[model samples]
Target: MFNNSIPTFKFLSYRRLQAGSLCPMGCNEDEYLHHISNSCSKIKDVFGHLNNWGFAIISCHSFADRCSWLEKKSSFIINLFCSTIYLSWKNRCEMVFGKTGKSPLSITTEAIGIASSLVICNHQNSGQLVVNQQDLLYKSWHPPPPDWIKFNVDASLLCSYKGGVGGVCHDHRGRLLLAFGRSCVHWDIAHLELLAIKTINEVFKDWMLEYNGIIIEGDNINIIKLIHKKIKAGMEGMEYLSFTKNFNHVICNWVNRDSNKLADLCANYAILSSFD
Candidate 1:
């Protein structure tokens, strides 16, 4: 009965091996399931949220070990893990092979949908278990602010190893309000972040738009933390010090990779612009 109960075990095992063998984010030789699932920066954007939801992640040496642990859980929990594993693998594929990386939120939404269908099927076969309301609610809807704006920025170093910053600002309706990319002599990621912030200040300085709240979104969480006072020492601190000295307005908190999609697109545009 248990053997037929969870098809996800097999699916997860197969996918994990496939992903591990050709792990595209340039995982080091020491990287394994635990490293990829827990520590890798490339994937942290996806799995980091699980910690907030009270999911205990155990590092296992073998697929069988991971599956054995998963099978002992409630169907809801089992399905959640399965969905996450599947989606993480999917996102890796999109990022490496397709060059079309999606945000963690979008990937999570898809994972839940896929897992819910599987769970429903399993429940129906096993005499219809009661569905958890919280799970259903989480799956059914996502509430984004009505009038918030998101700005995405990316920086790429050109010929002299000097970088260029690109950014795009978009409203809640996904309308592009401003898009610009500029070349800079900045040499490192930290300097690039500072450049992005400086460019944003220039935009606001010119437009003088009276916004109730604003979100400066970027894929670089280190820069975000530096801006938000979460961390004290780092490249972000230097950038923050510079930004505070120049700009007076308070920028809202930093967001994850998933929430900063528009910024990535703008960054890519900025890179492309350098060639022209």
Candidate 2:
């Protein structure tokens, strides 16, 4: 990108891959790397929010200026900058190909997630863990298949069995559609995880008509296995059946804790916020 090698619409048109130099994002302007970094409102919104996230990013008006600005930044910042740029371009391609394009907010979240995962991989390679690294890795959450809506759920418990259960629903593009967290007075971790899975329908009941496939992912492999093995033949079975009946496909999968961080964050937040 710094070498201006990215095949923007202008370049593609020059190479006869496109009909004209108009922006693929429909901004009605010639597409250029510089335009993406400087004038594109969508990418601009992403950077604006990223600055609020404490990256302290600066605005550079030209591709050369961007390169110069990145030269003085820390490696982490440079990686984040490059990641954001790449994601912005990917979103553009999705739109151009008639796929649902991500909003600026979703793009910003994805950039941060990618950067966070890279940072985690770096730390793991260095044989050191950052404080609360598990929490920081929540940004690594993955999206489901293009036709699915995924619910990631988790449970956090204290010694007294007082804790919280939380879950979040995201569409295939990783846009959060619904999030739910609830404080519980007394529940073991296993039951709590089960409850989190069981309540997914209640949280997403209204949106059932809007989505076709349902995927429930959690970090507790044992609990996930239990769910797959057998559901209780009572209210629990009915609830599960009703939710499944609404979707063409219902999938339950176990993810590693790192990939389930957002749900963990939500659960922990629920426990912490209950006292307030």
Candidate 3:
């Protein structure tokens, strides 16, 4: 992208490919790397939120201009900026090439989440003790209480908006009892996360009878809150709450994405395998 070699519609049209130069975002402007990454009205809110988070993104004319502007920023800022750009472009592709339409708010929220994970990882890799409560929460996975089973569930969403849910059940000793992953259809990550919990409920119906007390862990705090009754779960989310009736005692908790790596891998495998 920095070298201005990305195959934007303007570039493809200029090269005599059967493509239109007008922006796919309906901006009536040429579709180019810089325009898509910045200055597009459809994505203005995304950069606006980043600026509010102290990650200032300056609109530039060319890819080289963007590179020059980023040269003065810190490594962390550059990494986050690059990630946001990539996500914005990928979201655009999902709209133009796939059957997904994600809102700018969702994209901005996802970008911020990715940026937070980068911050946490950087602190850990630098051998610096993360003193922030949020950072500490993302440090590692904790084992369940004595005699209680723990289930870690996660949902993965591809750029095409294809999704998958996966989860694993482990005893108090951290011994894995069951693991499952399956492809799902959802345009929103939040819905997919809820689907993941529902899948765990269905998959472990028999285990719920055996294990009286269980804890469910997922990285999406909002979904955890929904399950806790702290937030509204609409009619659809209400359906996922059926697990509470099956288990004698169940705890749905939020864990760090880093700690949920195995579940994430399972989810990703489910989505990727469907393409094969």
Point out the higher-scoring one by TM-score: 2 or 3: 2
Q: How many backbone overlaps does candidate 3 show? A: 0
Worst 10-residue lDDT window for candidate 2 reads 130-139
Candidate 2 has what TM-score?
A: 0.51
**Candidate 1, 156-258: lDDT as tens digits:** 6666666668766654444345656676665587778757766876565334244434566665767776666632443354543343333334354555555
Name the lDDT value of residue 191 in candidate 3: 90
Best by TM-score: 2
TM per candidate: 0.38, 0.51, 0.49
| Inter-residue clash pairs, candidate 2 | none
Show how many residue pairs clash in every candidate, following the order shown: 2, 0, 0
lDDT of 2 by residue, 15-122 (tens): 998899987676888988888776777788889867754577787778888888888876667767888889988888888788998877567666765665566566
Clashing pairs in 3: none
**Candidate 3, run of 10 with poorest lDDT:** 130-139
Q: How high a TM-score does candidate 3 get?
A: 0.49
Residue pairs with backbone overlap in model 1:
152-263, 153-263
Shift of residue 27 alpha carbon in model 2, Å: 2.1
Ranked candidates, highest lDDT first: 2, 3, 1
